[model samples]
Target: MSTHVVVGVDGSVPATEAVEWAAADARRRGLDLRLVHVGPQWLHEGDAGHCARALEEAAGRARAVADGVKVTTEVLSGNVVEELIRESAAADALVLGSRGLGGFAGMMVGSVSLAVAGHAAGPVVVVRTAGAAGAAGASGHGTVVVGHDGSDDSRAAMEYAVEQARARHARLHVVSAWQLPVFSPYAVAYSGLVEDVVREEQAAARERVTPWRQANPDLVITDEQPCAHPVSALMDAAATADLVVVGSRGRGGFASAVLGSVGHGVLHHVTCPVAVVRPRQEDRA
Candidate 1:
């Protein structure tokens, strides 16, 4: 089956904004758009009409603004989380607003969006509403920011990031971060060793991305500082980037951990859209 992007909407302002963002991304990637509105199965029989109207409105707006992109809408009956995750299995990327109208009020992050971002097999994008909660109003609008940590999943995220950059004809900024050993703070003897380790990590991360830069000659790969805390570094880059990408699981996680710390942090903090990528099956084991 041809790949397409799926976006969940609830007829809220943020949800409509998310559809618009997903529509543009789908158009740029030459992918079709699927707009999903999930409701509880038989919760309120009369609610079906409301759901249909909302989805139809979203689809209409998507078609009007996103030219050349195939747009389709579905009003699904089931638990919202399960249905969205089900759709995610076949989607290239799942997109949603950071908060949902039915989930919470005046909250920066909603429960459903967090659940999908944590468990989706592929990448999941969380976009905030316009203003300070949304993508930064910074000068650089077409820049893509991706985080790397030398993990297999991170490599997968980088591959996706490169594709996104190429699709948007945008510059790619790769950021890698490393921390000093925990013992360094308490043991003066280990300070020098920690310093050496930090330097080694910095060099290794920089070297790890060298081939990616070489491979994507068409993308302007900007070298970013790799020594800051992973979350802070990525959030800083997001301040001006159009999108920020990270691996679903990082090097520090157990095999069963669904979402790594860095990915969760970026999802919560970045003003710009954040995509969390999972490594392929073969790469994970």
Candidate 2:
């Protein structure tokens, strides 16, 4: 299939970093890189060439970093998030920087990143700052971290994570989190049963991943069953990772509420690029 990676870049430091990351990623995957800049109507009246200038600068920056990759540029006029979502429908992935405004009520976590990741028809990656993802060429670097649970949504996430690890020759860290329900009717009775519940949950997670681990024998894999919240575990893993991967929605909990509050936390709070994977349109049907 025809595919390329689309990175939305504005003329900001974070956006520039995203362009570099996208270009590198595109080169690594042998795909084309498209730099997109969206401007409002007011920009046309005040500074018609603003979008052009931004795209030109971003394309040049990406070309410098990934010299051999095919690069293209685009300028769109309209609602930023809506236009991006539309653009993502035909791309392999939609990438965005970590910087965004808070003028809208629902744009809690870097508006465009969170909204597009939740509702887009494909994977949406929010690129983080360089320091947040650790220093360059350091030891124990560039691990691909993923949050996995025994859910179909999480399976898709793991699939993407494995592909990333294989492509980059990086270790895959699969983390599963467990927590006792605070509002259970037996809350008081099971106050001391948290460990028991966690053990069972960890076993289930391991069982789910066994087949995948056996299939990819050459890839280094680690299964972490942490007795903490999934977000907490994933964020900790992201601290020293090149990429953090997670499902667009999970089984039924904070993770399942990706379109709203939890989405903000996962995408905004993480220190590395976070890939929120969703099912393809054909698979969903």
Candidate 3:
């Protein structure tokens, strides 16, 4: 079956860019592209016609970029995030503009992108606009980075990242980070404590990637140790990578609810596109 990539659009410039990117990707991979637009019920009643026209225009732009790729568009009336989550479940992958019409300035990503990354059943990519400063990286193909922490969610993310790397024929960079607990000064002050801690964590990370590397010898693996912030380290690496993949939640944060801080932080700060993957609830539990 042809891979189906679903891109969420809200008639914004970023959304248009995402459509173009998705179109090019779909064409290159011999896949199908689905463009989805969701808005409030009032917008649907007041501006549904305009929304339809916008989708047509976006579709035209996508076709112009990569002709012959099967493109489909849909405008749904409901909560934007919920609709996107539902549609994404049926697709092999989901793509969205990093920020949309409604979002706070401090926020690196729009709420819709955050919601999808946090909850989508499959892999979700947040595409940044080209006009943004310091955003462009290695052309269509470059290094793909996946953040792993030995959790099931991170394992799932690694699986998706490996598949994407293979599909794009790009190098894969797997990252895992460890930091001393800030709340415990005693641990930091102890002699050789930090070194010992880092060594153990790095060892664990290497162990985690061992099987994956054995299975795919071609994958380029880079293990890193970012001070105390996983988010900052991931964002720094993502700036140079073609794609950054991370799990929606990790071991340290709120496990039963929304996305953790690192995932949320990367969503906002990374210059390159990011993919957030979540495993099934049973798997997570």
Candidate 4:
């Protein structure tokens, strides 16, 4: 694994928030913090200087917030999303603002942020703006939420979430949302069958985390298996969480697809910082 945390900088308020979040994470993980600003291809002389100042300012803010972390600055000129994805290949995690300067008004998630999160090699964290996040994004709640569905991808996300919760000395909330199969509208007297399915799903969800709970006896872990949509369950959990984590793709996702629908949906709606983690390259095989 890389020994540094990389965050994209664009001198926007949301970017500043992302820098603060990444800096604190770098401090916690004892990794170097790299502040990267990607300039457009048609960069003029004046624009180059402005990019430099933005990097410098971002670096200073990183140092102010995370004193011990080693911070570095880089200004790259290329396609913003492509360059950041390349950076993520060699970093522990890539952090970005929920939206950047190029973002349209009233847009919650920028195209760049979503594109990088979908294609990045490692974990990608999109930090929402304070005003946009509202109360859910406010003071730390000492709780980290993760979505799980007994899939390999979810297991990877769970591992990452466990490490984060342990580092923060916070509780881990494992949420598994399951839906019952739809029966024919004309069918009748299936109450017992519906009840049986619910019980089985609840049990399976609970069983999947039993080992994690037992293994980390000292770490407080809670499991929530709700009969609802995955996004809804996760959003409810993230309402008072410090962070919410989800795998890049889940079980039923297409093998060629990098980001799953649930992961993408949460990124657009979740009020807290969202981490989209993909299984390691080696593990995917």
Candidate 5:
């Protein structure tokens, strides 16, 4: 099957940057690109002819970046996140701007992007404002870092990271962090043992993906063992990565929720783009 990338755009600068980045990626990987613009239901009426026109212009911009890449335009009327999720259900991946033009003081990430990243069925890529233009000029050479903790969700993230690395011809950085019990009565006495246990956990994480790395010799694998919180370590590593891949949820608390603390923390802290991967409900059961 051909790869399909869905990009959410609303005529803002960040959305335009996301469209450009998604277009370049689709062109390089020989994938189809879908540009989606969602507005309030009231705008769908005669009040927002300009919104439809802007979507056409965005479509033209996407087409100019890549020739014959099956570029399609869509304008939906509903909640922004709901419309995006509905449209991107069958897509191979979803690319969205970190922030949009809605709400007061667009300093923080937009709610639409965060909602989709947390709950999308397939891989969701959140593109930030920085390196937006640079990403278009050059194919990404930096590595794709995926956070794995031996969970099914993390394995799904790894699968997406491997595919992205193959497409971009970049290295894959597999990272896992471990922390000792904070409230243990003998914490001081077992400090050394805790350190050793953390190291062993990191080693096991490395072993989990060894077979996949061996199969793809071209993939350079790097493992990290940070003596800090999982969210902080992953965010620090993501600063220099081309893309940060993470599971929707990890092994700790809130395992039943769609997004866990570590995933949510990275979404707000990381500067680079983040891809959250999750398996389908049927696969999980």
Candidate 6:
């Protein structure tokens, strides 16, 4: 495991907010903080001073959040996604703003943040502006949500979620959302069968978390298997969450999507800070 947290900094409001969140998390995890500024090769040719200033200012913001934390800054010249992905390989977690200016700029959650979340190793946290909750950062809501669908990735997500809950002394909610498979128009006769399958799925979902609950007897762990879309179920749970976590991929509704359909949707919709945890290389298979 790495000993520090790396945050992409571009001096945008969202990026600044991300620095704050990353710094706080670094302190909580007893890790150092590193501020990174990445830009295209062409931009770097003429923006040397600007890059330094951006990194310096971001480092200051990070220091303000945790004065005792050691902070460092670096300027990289290359494709934003590629450099950040490389950075993620050696960091405990890679943090980025949901949207940014300059190199990190885009609409809504932004393409860069989503792309990195999909490919980065370890955990990639996308911290959005305070739009949904009128404030950003982990606001001590005392709840953390994670989406699990019995896949390896989901299992990894649960591990990360459990650690986060323990760190914050928050509740952990594992959500498994399911839906009936598409049937032919004349398949109404299979209604009873559909109900049976739904019940089975719900039971399996609950069973998946049973071991976790038993092992962490002191921690408040809860599991919900709802007959609904994964994104909707997670969003509903996130409405009162301080942080929401999801894996890079999963089964069923999530499929093996780059970031998993559910994870991508949650990042765009969840009000709380979101963490996308990718399983280690050995566990990817």
lDDT per residue, candidate 2, 163-208, as tens digits? 8788778999998776666757756767558667777777887887
For each of the candidates, the C-alpha root-mean-square deviation to the true structure, in angstroms, is: 3.4, 3.3, 3.9, 3.2, 3.0, 2.4
**TM-score of every candidate:** 0.88, 0.87, 0.84, 0.91, 0.87, 0.91
Error of 2 at 284 (Å): 1.6
lDDT of 1 by residue, 142-232 (tens): 7889887667778888988998889877889988766554673567788778778877776777788889978888889986645657888
- Which is the leading candidate under lDDT? 6
Tens digits of per-residue lDDT for model 4 on 1-285?
A: 689999999888888888988888888778999998888778788888988888899899889888978999988888887899999998989998887663112224747777788788888998985743312223478898998876777888888899888877789999888777899877778878999998988888899899999888888999989887788788899898888998877752212224546777788788788998877687789
Worst 10 residues of 3 by lDDT: 131-140
Off by over 4 Å in 2: 41-46, 100-110, 131-140, 183-195, 252-257
What lDDT is obtained when candidate 5 is compared to the true structure?
0.73
Task: Tell me the whole-model lDDT of each prediction, alpha carbons only.
Answer: 0.75, 0.74, 0.72, 0.80, 0.73, 0.82
- For TM-score, candidate 1 versus 5, the one ahead is 1
Tell me the spans in candidate 6 whose CA falls farther than 4 Å from its real position.
Answer: 42-46, 107-110, 131-139, 184-188
lDDT of 6 at 205: 85
Candidate 1 error regions (>4 Å): 43-45, 102-110, 131-140, 184-191, 252-260, 282-285
Q: RMSD to the native, candidate 4?
A: 3.2
Residue 211, model 3: Cα distance from true site in angstroms: 1.0
Task: State residue 48's C-alpha deviation in candidate 5, in Å.
Answer: 3.7
Looking at model 2, residue 32 earns an lDDT score of 96
- Return the clash pairs for model 3, or none: none
lDDT agreement of model 3 with the native:
0.72
